[model samples]
Target: MMLVFALMLCVPAFACLAMAMERHQETLFGALLSAAASRVLRCAGWSALFVALWLAVAGKGWALGLVWYSGCTSLGAGIVYGLLIVFAKRMSAR
Candidate 1:
């Protein structure tokens, strides 16, 4: 959860700030969507990791295919995409 929140909020928040320094703007809706999507994706990716860990602890996580399978899980890109919208507004305002 912390990881997800950090990524969904802090990462972008700081990035936004840095971008703001250069002049960037984004809509509230965009931020919301970005946060939401990022949360979802982070959940999925972690879920995959959790599963993998569980399997490993059970002595099953390490499989011929499961190694690469972990990569199959995706942290949704929607977050950055949505964030981009909000960011776009910020930039335009300048």
Candidate 2:
């Protein structure tokens, strides 16, 4: 269950993190991520979502899987935001 949650969280976490990159500030909702970063995040998000689906198939039940996905994705978004802030500060200091 914990693993499932962690994997599910990877989706939005990467997506949001990519968007939070300094280079994206001028875009709408920071959607203008770099091509490489965008591709990587898109792949990661889809992979994580697929893994969650597999977990459901592996007897975790649809409800539990959905709940874990929701909770983890939300939590991951916040985590990514915090990480971006820390990294941005470090970069600026350099």
Q: Rate the local accuracy (lDDT) of all candidates.
A: 0.42, 0.60
**Weakest 10 consecutive residues, lDDT, candidate 2?**
22-31
Candidate 2 stretches with Cα past 4 Å from truth are: 1-37, 56-59
**Candidate 1: TM-score?**
0.29
Q: For residues 1-94, what per-residue lDDT tens digits would candidate 1 score against the true structure?
A: 3333323443343333333322232243333335555555456555545554444334433573344333322222345455667767676697
Q: Report lDDT (Cα) of residue 46, candidate 2.
A: 64
Candidate 1 pairs with clashing backbones: 24-90, 24-91, 25-89, 25-90, 25-91, 26-86, 26-87, 26-90, 27-86, 55-61
Top lDDT model: 2
Mind sharing the TM-score for model 2?
0.56
TM-score of each: 0.29, 0.56
